[model samples]
Target: MAARDYGQYSGITRAMELVGERWALLIVRDLLVGPRRYGELGAGLPRIPSNILAARLKELQAAGIIRRAPRSRVIVYELTPYGRELEPVVLALGAWGFKALDEPREEQIITPDSMTMDLRTAFRPLVAAGLPATAYAARFGVAELLIRVEGGELDVSRGDGEADLAFAAGPDIRRLISGQLAPERAISTGVVEVLRGRGELLTRFASTFHIAA
Candidate 1:
């Protein structure tokens, strides 16, 4: 059973009952990236209290949104098929929330999983289909990602690699993604520092991954 009841029969209410708790959707967000051990989940969400993490995991398991399975001889939590259905929903929610993001508070930290999803959310597949295949080694705060775009597909993974462009940005990369900051301006102002590759590819990156403000 869900942990709470609102005495309403609406689907929205039921969904809220299942995942509306603080940090519950964030757990789902990370799992959407891939399976994670309990410790890994905790590490990804360093702000969540350990007890709350344990309780949320139990509630999610009970609700059948996630399950534990043996992976490489270690148990990890992964989304069930039904839970995977939330991917588009989570992506849409991320896009909707993008407009509200300003600057990151000092306590906020970016994680690879979160950045992966953010790229997925902002990917313009049709636009990318017309562009040359591109690879980017990007850093947002401490998180490093290798991003590749070919045709209408995007692949993002942790760590660095050879790339057409390499750059580092803080949370202000949102400005570039939202088209509020042009590539030239971003580089000139130090909002993004080019570590390697041609600076012009940053324009392609901006065009390929954008969310209109």
Candidate 2:
């Protein structure tokens, strides 16, 4: 498909000319988290047609927003530094769109990238202050993330392994982080779990992330 030239005078229009196509910004959103193989991208966006995804990747690469790089033995799609500058734009848009999130219907699905990004946006250093270093394994059925918080800092990485705490990622995670749900209640209900001596880590984890939405 030929790129749409929305005239060069209007910056927003020109910007849209680069990312206005359906699923274009979403592709950017996924790449913001980290590099992904074609299959990983497909798993994150189940509804996007494979052909359309291919086309968008080619378009983005041409736009200098993303690049193909060889990682290990596979080629992975990653955002350029210029592309990564879109982080605030995407996150601000997400924060603005939060109010529009209606109650979940039967058809709604939350992608792992979205979940991880939400965690990124919701992290609050003040809340994490004075907390001991801790590691958590967050499992969300199809995805697993390792989150480490220490010295009022948070780091999240792909893959799951041993950690101070292990918890299932669900609707309750948001609620817990938001203080809408009590930590004990979440644990009692099996919505969260922790190692034998690491129960306090769960509460600390919940406190460290605050999602106002």
Candidate 3:
């Protein structure tokens, strides 16, 4: 599929022309983390129709934003170097959008990529620095995400392993990050389950990332 031509000389318009299609930027968002097979990408974007997803992928590939490569004898899609340069743009948009997250509505669904990217946008290195290095495995039923804070750096990845804490993603987790729900309440209410690691780690972990008010 061909991208729309905005016919505007502005760089912003040209950039938008490439990504303005529905699910285009979102596809890029999911690929920002790492290479993903078609199935993996579909998992992250459950709402997008398979046909639309395929079309968007074709458009992006043609535009040089992504490329297909063989990984472990299987094909996977990943962003090109030029595409990876959109990191700052994506993070900036994520940070700006946080203040609008008053409360998650019934219709609002949080995907693993959205959750992981939000953490990347919300991470406070100074706050993580004051706390001991920690790792967390967050499960969202559809997928599990690994978040690690070490030496004042934050890393978010797919898959799961041993961690300082683990919890199911839900309203309570959302509220906690937004500073609406307290850790104590989350535990007492059983909204978050501890699968491994010390309970105390949750407090420090909560402090490290916050959705903008």
Instruction: List lDDT for all candidates, in order.
Output: 0.94, 0.80, 0.82
The residue ranges of model 3 lying beyond 4 angstroms of the native Cα positions read 105-108
Candidate 1 global lDDT: 0.94
Q: State the lDDT at 180 in candidate 3.
A: 73
lDDT tens digits by residue: candidate 1, 97-140: 99889878988888989999999999999999999999999999
Arranged by lDDT, best first: 1, 3, 2
Winner on TM-score (1 vs 3):
1
Worst 10 residues of 2 by lDDT: 192-201
Q: What CA root-mean-square deviation does each model show from the true structure?
A: 0.8, 2.5, 2.2
Residue 137, candidate 1: alpha-carbon lDDT: 100
C-alpha TM-scores of all predictions: 0.98, 0.85, 0.88
Q: In terms of TM-score, how similar is model 3 to the real structure?
A: 0.88
Give every collision pair in model 1: none
Q: Candidate 3 on 1-213: residue-level lDDT in tens?
A: 456887779989878877789988888988887889999999888888999999999988988999999999999999999989888898888888776766567777777788788888878898888888888998865658899999889998878988879877564476777777788777777777777777767677679987746
Better of 1 and 2 by lDDT: 1
Give candidate 1 misplaced runs (Cα > 4 Å).
none
lDDT of 3: 0.82
Error of 2 at 151 (Å): 2.1
For model 2 the local lDDT of residue 108 reads 60
